[model samples]
Target chain A: MKGVTVLQSGGSNQMELADLSVPESGQDDLLIKVHSAAVNRTDIMTREGKAGYAVNPILGVEVAGTVVEAAGSGSFSAGDRVMGLVNGGGYAEYAVMPANRAMKIPDSISSAEAAAIPEVFLTAYQTLFWIGKLQKQEAVLIHAGASGVGTAAIQLAKQLSDAKVIVTAGSRRKLDFCRELGADILINYKEQSFDEEVLKATDGRGTDLILDFIGADYWDKNLASIKHEGRWVLIGVLGGSELSKVNLMPIMSKYIQLTGTLLTPRSDSYKAELSKDFAEVVTPYLEQGKIRPVVDSTFPVEKVHEAHQHMEDNQNIGKIILNIASAEA
Target chain B: MKGVTVLQSGGSNQMELADLSVPESGQDDLLIKVHSAAVNRTDIMTREGKAGYAVNPILGVEVAGTVVEAAGSGSFSAGDRVMGLVNGGGYAEYAVMPANRAMKIPDSISSAEAAAIPEVFLTAYQTLFWIGKLQKQEAVLIHAGASGVGTAAIQLAKQLSDAKVIVTAGSRRKLDFCRELGADILINYKEQSFDEEVLKATDGRGTDLILDFIGADYWDKNLASIKHEGRWVLIGVLGGSELSKVNLMPIMSKYIQLTGTLLTPRSDSYKAELSKDFAEVVTPYLEQGKIRPVVDSTFPVEKVHEAHQHMEDNQNIGKIILNIASAEA
Candidate 1:
C-alpha cells in the first residue's frame, strides 16, 4: 500500500509518498480501501512533526473508503461505502477504521464529499452542540466562517437548532459564501470591528454562543460579542494563542463558559460516541440534501502536497480532498 | 421596620441602620421576619457601592427567619421556619423571599446556621456540581479553603460525590478547618507552592475540577493545577482579575472548560431553579446533620460595620452572620 510519511531532515519535516505494508484491522475495526482523504490543519501540523498525538507516521485523519474486510459484528459488510475518522493512515491506499466510528456514506453523497464530512462536521458538531450546548433560537458567532469547521458549524447551528448564525470572515468572498449557507449576520473582520457589528446585529445583548477559531487576537472582541452566560468554544487558534494582559473580569461579569477543544486528541471511545451521535442526527440531513459537506477542491494522491499547500495558503473555502483511489488502482 | 442602608457620602459608602417600611410579599413570595442574615463578599461590595446588581439600598443577600406572611401557593404557612436567598433587603427586620427560593429550616439547624447556608452553600453547589459537573470520586481543588463557599464545597464534594477534595488556604488554621470539613489534601498557600502541591497530591495529573476564588494571582497556578479537560469554575476574583501575558495554548491543548459565574448577578428564575435543586439534593443531608453550615461568628445588626470590617480583615473562617432578631424585637 502507498502511504504518505513525514520525513524529517535538516531541522524541517517534509511529506513524502512511500510504499508501506497494509495496516491490520483490529477485531472491532474494518480494513478500508481508502477512496478519498481530506487535508486538515492538523495534518499539516502532523507533517511538520508538531502534533504530539499523531502516533501513526501516516498522514491524514479522515477518509471515505470501501470496507474491504468488515468487523465481526453485522453492523457493516465488505464493499460498503464508509466514511469516518481514521487513526491516521487516511492518506494511504488502505487504512483501518474502528467499526463504531464508521459512518455509512449516504447514497446521495460522493466519496470525495463524504471524506470532507467526518473531521470538520463532527468537530463542528461537537464544538457547537456537545460542548457549547447551543439552544434553539440562540445566536451563534462563528469566526473564520468560510473555513471547513466554521462552514459546518454555521450549517449545523442553522439546521439542527434553528440558531441565528452570525459569522466573521477576512474577505467579502468568504462572508458572502457564509451568508449563502445561512449566516444571518456577516462581519468582514478585516474591514469591521466584529464585536461592534455583533453588538449592533443582536440589539447589544450579543450572541449566546461563539465558535472561536482565532483565539488570542479575537479574545477580547469575542468576549464582548458574547451574551451574558454565553458559551465560547475554542476549536482553533489561527490568529494567535498567547494573550497579553487579558482582563478576565468581563468573562466573570458576563458568566461566560469557555471550552477549549481539539477533535483529534480525543479518546477512541469518545470519538466513537460522537461519531454515533453525529451520524444519527446528521445523516438524515445529508441524505435529504438539507446539509452538505463543502468540498473546496480535490487533488490526486500524488498532489497531496498541493492540497496541504492550498489549506496552508488559506486559499480554500472548505475542505481540500485527496483522491487516493486512482493512485491505489 | 429597620434595615441597613448604604449611605454614599463622597467617594466612600457607610452602612447605617434606618427606619424603613416593611417589605411586602408578592403573590409567590413570603414576607419573612428576619432572624439572621449572612454577610458575603457581595454584601461587602454592595455596602461599598461596588455591586451593580444590588438595587436595594439595604445590605445582605441570604437570610433565615419565620414566615410572617406565606405565599398563596400553600408551599409554606405563616410561622414556618425558612432560609433562602433574597433579591435584596435581607438586612431588614422584614424581607420578602420568593417562595421557590425558600428552603425549610431543619429542626437540627439554627437560624444563624441556616442563614450561613444559602449564599455560600448554594454558590459551592452551583460551582461544583451544576457548572463543574463533578462526577463520583473525581478530585476537586477548592481555593480559600476556610472561606464560606470553600468549606461548603469541601463538605459537599466529600458527602455528595465522595470526591477527593484538595484545598489551599493562607494559614494552618484555615487548612485545619478544611481538613475537618472532609478535605483530603491541604496546601497552605502562604507556605507552599499550591500548584506543585496539587500536582504531587494528584500524582501529577492535577484535580478534575477547580473552584477558583483568587483570580489573577492564582491564574498560572490554577492553570497548572487543573487536569486535562478539567473544569475551572471562577466564582470570585479576590486577588485580582487582570492576567498578563497569559498562554492560552495549554487551555486548548488540555481541553479545559473554564466558566466564570456569580450567583448574585444571576436571574430570579435561575436562582429559584438552583434553590429548588439544592433543596432537593441537600435538604435530606442537612436534616440528618450529615452536612452543616460552618458559621464563624455572629454580630448584632447594630454592629453591621464591624461585621464588614471583620470580613475585610479576613479574620473569620466560614460565614459571618448578622443577628437581626434582637434588633427586630
Candidate 2:
C-alpha cells in the first residue's frame, strides 16, 4: 500500500508518498479502502513533528471509504460505505478504523463530502453541546467563522439548539459564508472590535457561549463577549498561547466556565462514544440536507503539501480534502 | 434595632454599632431576631467599603436566629429557629432573610454554629457539586483547608461522595484540624511544595477537582496538581488576582474546566435554588451530627471590628462569629 510519510530530515512541509504494508484490522476494527481523506491542522502539526499524540506514523486522521474487511460480530460489513476518524494512515490506499467509531455514509453524500464530516463536525458537536452545554435560544460566538470547526459549530448551534449564532472571521467573503450558514451576527474581526460588536448585538448581556480559536490574542475580548455564567470552549490557539499580565478576577466575577479540548488526543472509547452520539443526532440532518459539509476544495494525494499550505494561509472557507482514491473505480 | 455599620470616614476596620430601624420583611422574606452572624472576608471588604454588591450599609452576610415575622404565605412561622444568607444586615439585632433561602436550624446545632453553616457550607456546596461536578469517590484538593469553606468542603466531600479529600493549609495545627474533619491528605503549604505533595499523594495523576481559594499565587501549582479533565473552581482570590506571564496552553491540553464564582453576588433566585438543593442533601447530616459546623470563636456584636481583624490576621480556623443576642434568651 502507498501512504504519505513525513521525511526524517524535517522542516516545514516535509512529506513524501512511500510504499507501506496494509494495516491489519484489530478485534473490533475495520480495514477500509480509502476513498478520500480530510486535511486538518492536526495533520499539519503531525507533519511538522509537533503533535506529541500522533503515534501513528501516517499523516491523516479522518477518511471516507469502503469497509473491505469488518471485525467479527461488528455492525459494519464488507463493501459498506463508511466515514470516521482513523487512528492514522488515512492518506493511503487502505486504513484501519475502529468498528465502534465508524459511521455509515448516507447514500446522498459523496465520498469527498463524507470525509469532511467526522473531525470538524464531531469537534463542533462536542464543544457546542457536550462541553459548552449550549441551551435552547442561547447565543454562541464562534471565532474563525468560516473555518471547518467554526462553520460546523455555527450550523449545529442553530440546528440542534435553535441558538443565536454570532461569528467572527477575518474577511467579508468568509463572514458571508458563515452568514449563509445560519449565523445571526457576523463581525470582521480585522476591522472592528469583536467584543464591542458582540455586546451591541446582544444588548449588552453578551453571548452565552464562545468557541475560541484564537487563544492569547482574544482572551480579553472573549472574556468581555461572554455573559455572566457563560461557557467558553477553547478549541484552538491560532493567534498564540501565552498571555501576559492576565487579570483572572473577571472570570470569577462573571462565573465563566472555560474548557480546553482536542479531539485527536482523546481515548478510543471516548471517540467511539462521541461518534455514536454525533451520528445519532446529526446523521438525519445530513440525510435531510438540513446540514451539509462545506468542502472548500480537494487536492490529489500528491498535493498534500498544498492542501496543508492552503489551510495555514487561511484561504479556505471550509474543509480541505486530500483525494486518496477515485470513488468511481 | 442595632446594626454594625461601616463608618463613612474611610479606614480599615472602621465599623460601629448604630441604632437602626428594624427591617420590614418582603413578600417572600422572614424577619429574624438575630442571635449570631458569621464573619467573612466579605464583611471585611464591606467595612473597608470595598464590596460593590453590599447594597445595605450593615456589614454581615449570614445569620442564625428565631423568626419574628414570616411572609404571609411562607413555610416558616414566628418563633421558628432559622438560619440563612441575609442580603446585608446579618450583623444586626433584626435581619431579614429570603423565606425560600432560609434553612431550619438543626436542634443539635447552636446559633453560632448555624450562623457558620450557611455561607461556607453553601459556597463549598456550590463549588464542589454545582460547579465542579465532583463524582463519587473522586480525589479533591481543597486549599485553605482549615478556612470556613475549606473545612465545610472536606466534611461534605467525605460524607456525601466518599471522596479522597486532600487539603493544603499554612500550619500543622490547621492541617491536623483538617485531618480530624476527614481530610485524607494534609500539606502544610508553608513548608512543603504542595504540588509535589499532591502529585506524590495521587501517584502523579493529580486530584479530580480543586477548590481553589488562593488564585494567582496558586495558579501554576493548581494547574500542575489537577488531573486531565479535572475541574478547578475558583471561589476566592486571597493570594492575588493578577497572573504575570501566564501560559494557558495547559488548560486546553489537560482539558481542564475552570470556573470562578462568588456566592454573594449571585442573584436572589439562584441563591434560593442553591439553598434549597443544599438543604435537601445536607440537612439530614447536620441533624444527625455527622457534619457539624466548625466555629473557631465568637465575639460580642459590639466587638465586630475585632472579628474582622481576627480574620484579616488569619489567626482563626473555620468561622468567626459575631454574637448579636444570647441564644438562651
Off by over 4 Å in 1: A9-13, A71-73, B9-13, B71-73
Give candidate 2's error at residue B37 in angstroms: 0.9
Q: Quote the B-chain TM-score, candidate 1.
A: 0.98
Model 2 residue B124 lDDT score: 97
Indicate the worst ten consecutive residues by lDDT in candidate 1 chain B.
B6-15
Clashing pairs in 2: none
Model 1 iRMSD vs. native: 0.8
Per-prediction TM-score, chain B alone: 0.98, 0.97
lDDT of 1 at A232: 92
Q: Write the per-residue lDDT of candidate 1 for residues A1-329, one digit (tens) a residue.
A: 89988788212137788999999998999999999999988888877777878888898899999999996947999999999998899999999999999999999999999999999999999999899998999999999999999899999999999999999888989989998899999999888999999999899999999999888999989988999989999888898888887887888899999999999999999999999999999999999999999999999989887787788889789999999988856
lDDT of 2 by residue, A1-329 (tens): 88898986354468888888898988889999999999988888888778888878888999999999997835988999999999988999899998999999999999999999999999999999899999999999999999999989999999999999999999999998998999999999999999999999999999999999889999999999999999999989998999987997899999999999989999999999999999999999999999999999999988887887888888998999989884223
Docking class of 2: high
The CA-based lDDT of model 2 is what? 0.91
| Tens digits of lDDT, candidate 1, B10-73 | 1213777899999877899999999999988888777666787888778789999999888685
DockQ of each: 0.82, 0.87
lDDT of each: 0.91, 0.91
